[model samples]
Target: MKIKPNKLRSISIVKGQLKNVKFCIGDDPIPTVSEQPVKSLGRWYNASLRDKDQVQQVRQDITNSLENINRTLLPGKLWRLQFGLLPRVMWPLTIYKLPITTVEKLERTMTSCMKKWLDIPRCLTNISLYGKGVLELPITSLTEEYKFSKIRLQMTLKDSRDQTISNAEQPIPSRPQPSSERDRKSPTYALCPTPATLKHILTGCKTSLTQGRYTWRYNQVLKSLAAALESERNSTNSLPLRATNSITAPTFIREGQKKPNHPPTKPETGQLAMARDWKMLVDIGQQLIFPPEIAATTLRPDLVLWSPSLKSVYITELTVP
Candidate 1:
């Protein structure tokens, strides 16, 4: 191979101190020393040989990208953050060795930007931001992405064809085991006298039932649904009517028989369109009583909508799994 002495750069990496290094190509001295950090394969390496510089560079890049995104006057901020920013951030997180604390800090910055973009209060918890609630929004958590990327990278390394890596003994960490003493005398055990499993804590806990946790969650969902229904019932726009004038073509025809042609008539409007008086009863603070005139039953539904003029009623029941 032909060597270019002028293009070559040299730097000595040592534990105590970096020594002045010189290189030669066939006794021709190459005196250039690369004092600054060098970039190779999208990662920076300096004399220190640590990833601190790379981490700082990544942080700066992310901060600048986030600032630019915040300045742009665009709709679908959440969409941009999820599809655009997250992928860019995950690439670096997957390649570089970063501390969990640094990832958490980056997440905090992203979270702040998200709340600002959504015009939500800063006091809102992170759980509400990422949780699958009644009115859930599309959002991604950076910390979760970081962890997923690391795990994927680990799996790739573990399955690599390189003999050294494949044959090397790697320690696999296990999750912390639950204490037997704590399990027997857990707070939930005192109330329900059952094993402290996830199902019991979420649904079957006697203490949780007495505390109205399930009821509160159910009511929250019911309230949102009822509000939307109430708006539709009170709307000035006419109710959606089925198309009666248009006729659907027959799927099959006999060998000797011809297709029938029907004349088009005026579309039929809904019967409730003429009746404007609509009343609604929601089950929140009090039990929902079904109208005795409509249906003589003891069943207490979640919501009831009735129209006296049309002599029609709509009953709704909400269940969350």
Candidate 2:
């Protein structure tokens, strides 16, 4: 096949590419050379044949597109990111070996835009948002989502192929439990209750509580429950029965869940200051506990005071908002 000068491009994939190498197409030396990646079949490939260039290009494009988006779109930009931006990135994520740093960069860009869209102040930290119902998904979470997408797509493709040969008699594999008996007995494998597990259980309860006869808001319910628990503690002149043995509850893996409200903008430095003040203010006979876990549940009171004279515990939820 005859190739025109305009259709020809050359690049070196090797380190320290050889110099003075010339090529001739029908006795005409092709002098023009380039190292830039070429686009073909709707995909970009660099001379090194590595995915680095593709990742960089895709990131740049996404960043540009995000910059053009208006911050006033309520949830619309988020929806677009989930459906449009995410789908576009999937192909590159699967085909290219993208570094975690690159993924983090993408996440940071998205997060910055999201915060702007939400009109959230810069002073608010991720932990604060997490405390409330706002979902503060990390960069790794987005990567995990892409991985799931790739796996789902592969499974679908495999299923399609399997259906074509369903008529053929296939040997069924032996049924073996995915988990080993030893694994089940291992300490790591044991289900231990964690703050996360407690949160999940509580959030599930939240859903039920909201739809039930009690039409109270989630925060209101939390406050009411805390107050009731405090009252019980006061009457007993000791820890509430619900709190007994809470420290040694069985542990389990914790999954991320959406919080009902945004956490107050309390920085770690400020929290430390509050802790110091609490230590100084309490009397000799009283004990102050920060973030008292209730009945091993994830719900925590910001401050709890145990008064020996009054024989009661008081719960406090501090707010600087």
Candidate 3:
């Protein structure tokens, strides 16, 4: 049966166990014994590595990280990520380094299987490649696949014919299921965005839903975030950052929650709700580089100004009127 959008439920699947999985209202009704639980975050990628050699080293550094995944797969942890009961567990899981090419391949694969465009969130695909690859999956509600295709995808990489997963193949997941193994599509909900639209929304481009020209203005935000990460890495930065996926902000933030900030007081529910609603109205990289001044406003700016000598960024919140 197709997933019901309003009553839509999410299921996390392990490799070779697709048929055994099941979903029900909320996070209730644990999946069957045949099914393994989904981890809270996308598989974590090394953010510092720039090459294969570096990636290999990163793999070594996080040997213990798998403990988290292993624990998470233990049903309890899986439930947390699925329903996001424990947001902290969501970190450390992000796009390690995926190539843009690989990301495109993933998009094609996801859209093809779904048989229609569904907004697969950037955090949900091959987004970790940003470190060495060009793209990473987003961790947002944008993706609501018929099944856990990506999860099984990574598993296929492990069970490679040669047992040596390709770097290029590292990001582009494999489908182990038989070509004819067509799982029933979940109820498709029109209320939310789809994969095709997310492609543009996350980019510095436009979308069918938003008249806000250059709705992807937030790509700069990611651009900025990338730059910050690079600088932080270069500067012997403190503990690194991670996203449940590649990590980002905007509409992707949990509804009614504010971006991480030490506001003097909790934002009023009215304002928080408004921010949440406006977030969906436009799309931009959840993270990007931009001037500090320009970063504050909710409205899109007409122009961005920077001066290296002064080390400053100036943004003009355009007046349409």
Off by over 4 Å in 2: 1-5, 11-20, 27-36, 71-75, 121-141, 149-321
Descending-TM-score candidate ranking: 1, 2, 3
Better of 1 and 3 by lDDT: 1
TM-score, per-candidate, Cα-based: 0.47, 0.37, 0.14
Q: What TM-score number comes out for model 1?
A: 0.47
| Model 3 segments more than 4 A misplaced | 1-67, 71-75, 80-97, 100-321
User: lDDT per model, in order?
Assistant: 0.77, 0.53, 0.36
Tens digits of lDDT, candidate 3, 26-123: 65554442333233254422221134443343344333333454444254433333344223322222224433453344434433322222334544
Model 1, residue 318: C-alpha shift (Å): 58
Q: Score candidate 2 by lDDT.
A: 0.53
Give lDDT: candidate 2, residue 223: 58
Model 2, 107-194: lDDT tens digits are: 6677676677668986666554323245644223455666676677566666666765542433323223327777654323323233
Best by TM-score: 1
